[model samples]
Target: MNLFELVEQLFEQYGYLVLLIGLPLDFIALPIPPGNSTLTYTGFLTYKGIVEMVPAFGSAFIGAAIGLTITYILGYKLGMPLIERYGKWLFIKPSLVEKTQVYYNKYGNKLLIICFFIPGVRQFIGCFIGMIRVPYRTVWIYGYTGVAAWVISFFSIGYIFGEQWQYILNVVEHYLKVIFICLACSFLILLVWNRVKREKAKKLSNATRNE
Candidate 1:
């Protein structure tokens, strides 16, 4: 069956349990019913009076938080060690880690606030933060805030649009992908420029020292 049909069937069968289960899977990167689909459908059901708004939202939020916490704990306990052992197979050497650490020092913590809206980023962000040893306090503050915004925005879309939710969701997702692509390209360009600038400075300093 199609994705929409699958979600509708599950919701019909399990009610809020689906949210409690499905959202966690999505956050854990399994995404069987997909987080976006679940939230928007919850709002759609609320609009149809089949589901209570507050409870549905609460279930979603709690489920997401649980999943995020699990990933963080796993990363904290195991991620770096595993990478140090097996990262060579994945080409994740120490130099790569250092470069990533540099970028994370600059933008990673703040990125949590909007990571939920960034598609592929949302799934691994909690683990990433933990792997970098970012404090739980920072994750709780920025991460939960981002989750609230994400849930509210997509849920509002389905509720507000009502019968057109599926169409609207498709349109919204398409544009978001385009925007993310553009932003990723720009970020890469800036990174390349910064690297070149640093290299030039290093070479210039070496030349001066030799003279």
Candidate 2:
């Protein structure tokens, strides 16, 4: 099944169990939107009295922490060695991981906390933080902080609007579309600006060298 159907099925079949499991699994690099749809559904169910909000939010938070810890362990055990041994075979981009490490080194622990809200990279931030050798304590503090933020923000919003779960879902889908379009436009603009700047820089450098 496609992603939308799969998520809907998850909501229908597993509900709280899926949120508990999925939140962690997302941290492990599963391509699931655990941060958004899962939390939204969980909130809806909590309001429906099918699941208690505390258990739902707390379990999800714990699961996310465990998942991130496991990711760090796996990265520590295999991430570097795998790169050294076979990353070339896997179409891996070494610079992305390297840059991520550099950011951790320069910024300290804040980057980890910030990445949790970013849709795609949040999963990898855990692994990258470990591969970059940020202290485990720092990683946990930053990662868990993100989990707490997501759990509290989404779950609380859901609980408060339980009466309008379906309406909220519709609004969310609409917003997702808006978010995607805005991101696309932003990326295109950035790309164009970078290209123009690169060309200008190259001309200036060449002129300086000629003199």
Candidate 3:
């Protein structure tokens, strides 16, 4: 069978086992779309009475938490040396520039909490925080909080909408709307941040020239 067929069959036969395996791999740097798919699949399973909603949520939560923690530790330990040795080799020196440094320097650690909820930044933040050797307890605090919020949000949607496909569709539609709204907000924030940084650089440069 093709890949899609294989996945469909897997979900049909052994959803819980498939989820437990896939989620961890996805979190630990595997190129897999585990996020929405797993949640949606679990909901479908619940609708079919193949799995209990509570059990599915709990298992997925633990799986995600453990998986993310592993990545966080790996990032903390391995990321810095690599970044230091050949950041430019990876085309990331621009982000490692003065502006990002200033942003990190000013934020002074609270960025960890915010970064955990943001999509692309979360992985890098885990690495940066890990490299800095931020306390394990602190990491766990924000990390678990993040996992809890994410799990509760998605699973509840699945559970509440589990009875009918149309209900599930509405739930997914709502999520899509929110995701797009967040995307728009992110774009606007980036635009503003870039503008502010440019103006600050101009002012700093003029002041240095005068001095």
Candidate 2 lDDT over residue span 1-211, tens digit each: 9754576577577766776678877877784765666677677677777677677887878877777788888787778777767878886666655754664577647655655656666677666766767787776677788778867766765677876765776675576567656755865686588679999999999999999
Highest TM-score against the true fold, candidate: 1
Rank ordering of all candidates by lDDT, starting from the highest: 1, 2, 3
Q: Tell me the spans in candidate 2 whose CA falls farther than 4 Å from its real position.
A: 1-16, 31-35, 89-99, 166-211
Candidate 3: lDDT over CA atoms? 0.64
User: What is the TM-score of each predicted model, taking all chains together?
Assistant: 0.92, 0.67, 0.66
lDDT of 1 by residue, 117-166 (tens): 76787888877777778788988888888888899999998888999999
lDDT of 3 by residue, 70-167 (tens): 87788677876777778778776634543454555455355455443444554455556666566778767776777766666555655566656446
Candidate lDDT scores, in order, read 0.83, 0.71, 0.64
Give the worst 10-residue stretch by lDDT in candidate 1: 93-102
RMSD (CA, Å), candidate 1 to true, equals: 1.7
User: Model 1 residue 34 lDDT?
Assistant: 74
